[model samples]
Target: MDIVGDSGATGYGVVDPHNGWVAKMRLAMPNTRINNYAHDGAMVSDFLPGGRWPDTTDAVRRIGVDQPSLVFIELGGNEYYIDRDPAQYKANLETLTQNIWQVSPRSTIVYETIWPFDPRQSTSMHSWDEYGAAMQQLAVEYSAGWIDLRQFFPPHYADDTYTHLLNTDQIHPTDAGNVVEYTAVLNIINRC
Candidate 1:
């Protein structure tokens, strides 16, 4: 019942991992083993290891060993940040999904949309909505579930914003955001 993904799922913006969504979820579900395999700036595509992170295949192998009941993959922004080609990104993501299914047939996979960050949205790489839609499409294609994290995030341009839900870098979520994220996942898991 743990999770996976990039910096947002890795507690990059926080001082302690215990304050991250994974830890909060562990606290919420004491019986659940939420092993944290996420890394900062992780991509859906298979590639060399990032700082302290194994490549996608190795990571998936490790997670498969755990046989996680539910796998939450929060990805996409890194694809844009790395400026990956859209078609290639789609292929890479599909492959990753297949690998997960091959390794854990009984597991439930959920593809999460990136948060509603305006600057990232304005990038020439790809609109944030485009990424979200791509994730949704893949989720449906694979008969998996999807969660648009944007719904839990307040707009970046509100008159009184910066509710500590996101970091100043505007990429990853903050400690407060981790709380909201845990709530969002909990809600979705309950529904499922």
Candidate 2:
């Protein structure tokens, strides 16, 4: 099976040196063809028609209607920057997830929860719990599975350390951190 990973899916580094879930999955199953399209700092809004973010339609086109075996969505963290209204966030996410199903009904869609963020990184525009809950609800509405990444990281890393996921900024995953997140994802996928 071929796998396409999005922003949250792309770990630290150009070669993606860290062992992300995709890397582990590929290692576990040598036959799997895994492609990483996940760009760090990507928002679900980016995949839409005219959003400032990168659009997935091009990526979807790259898949060429053949529909890969699986499409993993790791977005929404950046969406928090847009505004903090949980209801609005839910509506936007609902539309995006539904569109994925509509476009590739046969491919499995995995919606991952945003890891707990450091309050220091974000303005008071929204709360982390609200964003996390909105994502969970979207998973339920779409009949897709949700993976809570917060469970994988050390509890001590919950605060400003969240910003350390990327060396450049607090949002993107560093190489090592990406490996951890990837491992968490792999564990979840293995259970299924």
Q: Pick the candidate with the highest TM-score.
A: 1
What tens-digit string does per-residue lDDT give for candidate 1 at 78-135?
8777566767677777777777778787889988886776554444666567777777
Off by over 4 Å in 2: 1-7, 13-21, 53-55, 82-84, 119-123, 154-168
Range of the 10 consecutive residues with the lowest summed lDDT in candidate 1: 46-55
**Model 1 root mean square deviation, Cα atoms:** 2.7
Query: Model 2 scores what on Cα lDDT?
Result: 0.62
Tens-digit per-residue lDDT, 20-133, candidate 2: 556656777787677666666556655656655444545554444656666777776766655547787677667666666677778777777756545343456677678888
Local accuracy by lDDT, each model: 0.75, 0.62
Q: For model 1, what is the C-alpha lDDT against the true structure?
A: 0.75
The TM-score that candidate 2 achieves is 0.76
| Reference-based lDDT, residue 7, model 2 | 52
Model 2: colliding residue pairs: 5-38, 6-38, 7-38, 7-39, 21-182, 163-170, 165-174
